[model samples]
Target: MKLNSAQLGKHLQGKLAAVYAVSGDDPLLCQEAADTIRSSARSQGFSERQVFHCDASFDWSLLYEAGASLSLFAEQRLIELRIPGGKPGDKGSSALIDYLARPAEDTLLLISLPKLDGSAQKTKWAKALIDNADAVFVQIWPVETAQLPHWISQRLAQTGLSASQDAVELIADRVEGNLLAAAQEIEKIKLLADGTPIDADYVLACVADSARFDVFGLIEACLNGDAVHALRMLDGLRGEGVEPLFLCAMLARELRLLSGLALQISQGTTPDRAFAAARPPVWDKRKPPLHKALQRHSAGRFNHFLLELQQVDAQVKGQAAGDPWSSLARLCLQLAGQRLLLEA
Candidate 1:
């Protein structure tokens, strides 16, 4: 069974599953989902915990050992398997399928991974974890801009703090596409809330200008086909220590959006109608640059960029030979309609 973060809470109220798989494009939500499972496991007498980090050199048998081993201190335990790359390879795949096939009694297996693309979800190991009757998959997606304010409001309420619409809106603006920062801002404000409903003035006084050169801005620059601005923003983001994987991830999101809209436009759908039909329904203010973006690239080219991003991912992970930053700059330029004749 698959559930979102919202649904996971209510699901946890019932008996916990034998295996749980959680993945998302957003690290914050993924972490929260895993944490929730951990908490639920603990409350249900899973007092012992073991964590395994899967890497290129990881031994697959250790996972099997972890699953079958008897707990030393507690009768029930939680075993966590974290696959940052979201690939379990041949041996690990077999191990996962075998372990999940006969998951240990009195143990809860929690597998956390990076967001699995559609193709990844079809893999043997992935299907074993997901399609198994004893397993629950929690897939977390990023909060879109149009929904960020309400998300912020809900988050604020959790901290025993209330905020005016303008206040939450301001926080949303400062932390657009960055939920970690939004959560931090909310925590920071909790210390200062002091029994008063937050207003924009309070937010302005408490919040710092920390969102300079965020990925969303870089995306907007690319969508507008402003090569110079996009490159500069890329440089700024790199200078600010943003991971190339993160930059690539956000850029890939826009490319997906562009690819979908481009296909629609190519099939006789108006850009306006395509935007309206978008999964999240593009906001009016964000549609203009996307409209411009649609004019510059064909749907095929957008897909090509996404394919190249896979190489970028490999490079970032040191599995490929080249600088991902260089690749990203090339993508930025090309995304902005500036096709380069040579690789820099």
Candidate 2:
């Protein structure tokens, strides 16, 4: 049966199923669902758990061996397969279909895959799994810009804490809706608090000096006309262990939002209306940089920046090969007018 993350806990409370497939772009939700399945099965005497990571070089026969293999301890087993790229080749697909044809009675198989798009879900492999396994798909929802405050409050409540309106707004400003980063920040706050009320002061103290910097910071610094600070923030992001490709993604997203807003404004939309039209940042402070970015940048410039990010993403994925960091650094230099390129 098909289920979302919200339905997973209750579904898992009863007897464990023979097979499960957890898929989504929301990493936190996806991992949580997978953990729930694994944890529940372990509690039900499925002590032997096997794991496989599917890479380009992975052999599909491994999954076949996994399905047919018996546990050495003569106990119930759980096999987990994670497909990062989400495209298992012909052999892998065939193996999965065959295994699901008659899933083992005592063994619970769990598969974690990246979010499957419409095309993928319609494929024979996906159909066989959906038709056979207990499937849960946790799709990421796009947060509305105006509903950010409510979202923050809800997120906080999950950690046995509550936040003041101002605190919600403050965090909303800082994180701007990158849910993964926002979730991490909440975990940090939960660790620091001593059963006291979490307010704006608590948020400022916890998040204001965060070591991690995302693409939003880079675009914000650039729009604020602090090219030096922008570069420094970019460097800090690297120091914080943020991947170069991810950084490029943030820049790309910011540019897309800015360009879309600028175009709307040119067509005679007001700032408040534009703000309403924009996607809410993972943090509320993001609204201001987005606001400032709209003022400082032309629609054309933002569009160009997005294209640069796309090029970087493509290169990092190996579709177009090059030194990704060097390409990223070059993009930054251009942002600072340290490199010359013809304006598109």
Candidate 3:
């Protein structure tokens, strides 16, 4: 069965499905949808949970193993498989199809992916999930710019506070359609304003610029080869208290993809063929900018990015010298085809 994000909460109030596939670009809503499922399951005696983050090297057999293993701690289990890359290659597709053929009893398998494009929706694994009688597919869409104020107003009501009309408009304008930032700002105002109704002045005092410079934006800047913009975004992200390890992890995902593409090219595969043959099959829209990035770095350079991420991880864990943020800046600069001469 298929449902929108709005229908998920009500649906969960009834019987829980054996499997769920949640896909969307709205991170906050997607996360909340997954959380709602877990919470509902927990209340009904699901005390055990396991999570898997799927990448190119992920072993699909684990899905079968996890399903077969009985959890001793609880009567039910919540198994979440997150595919940030979205495309579950041949093995993943087959595993999902086979597993969905007979979903385990007393286990809720939640598979989360980025928003599915037309072609992705037609894949065999996607069909297995969506076409199943016992599965629920929830598609979360982003809050459009025009709907921002109403969305903020709804969130405020849920947070046990109301906001003046001007205050809602000011926040909607400042956040520029970034739901995560808007959510954070609303939570902040809840603390500062207490039970008092929020106003335009209160919002202005409490929120920052609200133009989110998240890891995704930083990656786009690097891919587009805008070194200066990338640096500015890096600075903004760090100043906003984004963790160095989080940034490195995201950057590393991109670098690993690039490395695979570069390696294929070095083996005489045409860029077009390399992208098409890519494990997660590079979507057509991303191929252009990725092609640009591929030209800026070779297989060896992309391998070096893996090494740099290792160092950044160590720095974050306090197991190494030098600042992690500095290392991240250097990596970003190099990815954007610029070498930093001074301290990053």
Q: Considering lDDT, where higher is better, how would the candidates rank from best to worst?
A: 3, 1, 2
Error of 2 at 7 (Å): 1.0
lDDT by residue for model 1 (67-141), tens: 778899999999888899999899999999998789889989899998897889999999988899999999998
Model 2 global lDDT (CA atoms, 0 to 1): 0.75
lDDT of every predicted structure (CA atoms):
0.89, 0.75, 0.89
What's the residue-level lDDT of 124 in candidate 1? 93
Q: Please identify model 1 stretches exceeding 4 Å from their true place.
A: 212-220, 224-294, 297-344
Q: Compared with the true structure, what per-residue lDDT tens digits does model 2 show for residues 1-344?
A: 77877677887888776888888766766777788888899889999888999888888888778777778974898888899988888878888888878786678888888878677988898888877644444443346547767877898898888988998888876765566667778888889988868899988887754343656667667766566767777777777888876787677766677788889888899867877766672234466666666775678877887787787888888988787776776676555544355543
Q: What TM-score does each of the candidates earn?
A: 0.70, 0.63, 0.65
Q: Cα lDDT for residue 228, model 1?
A: 85
Q: What TM-score would you give candidate 1 relative to the actual structure?
A: 0.70
What are the clash counts of all predictions, listed in order? Answer: 0, 15, 0
How would you encode candidate 3's per-residue C-alpha lDDT over 1-344 as one tens digit per residue?
89998899899999899999889998999999999988999988888999999999999999999999988888899999999999989899999999999899899999999999888899888988999999999999889879999999999999898989999999997786889999998889888886666899888888888776878878988998988778888999988899887887888889899999999999999999999998888877688889899998898999988998999999999999989888888888888888666634
Task: List runs of model 3 lying over 4 Å from the truth.
Answer: 213-344
Better of 1 and 3 by TM-score: 1
Q: List candidate 2 segments past 4 Å from native.
A: 133-148, 208-344
Better of 2 and 3 by lDDT: 3
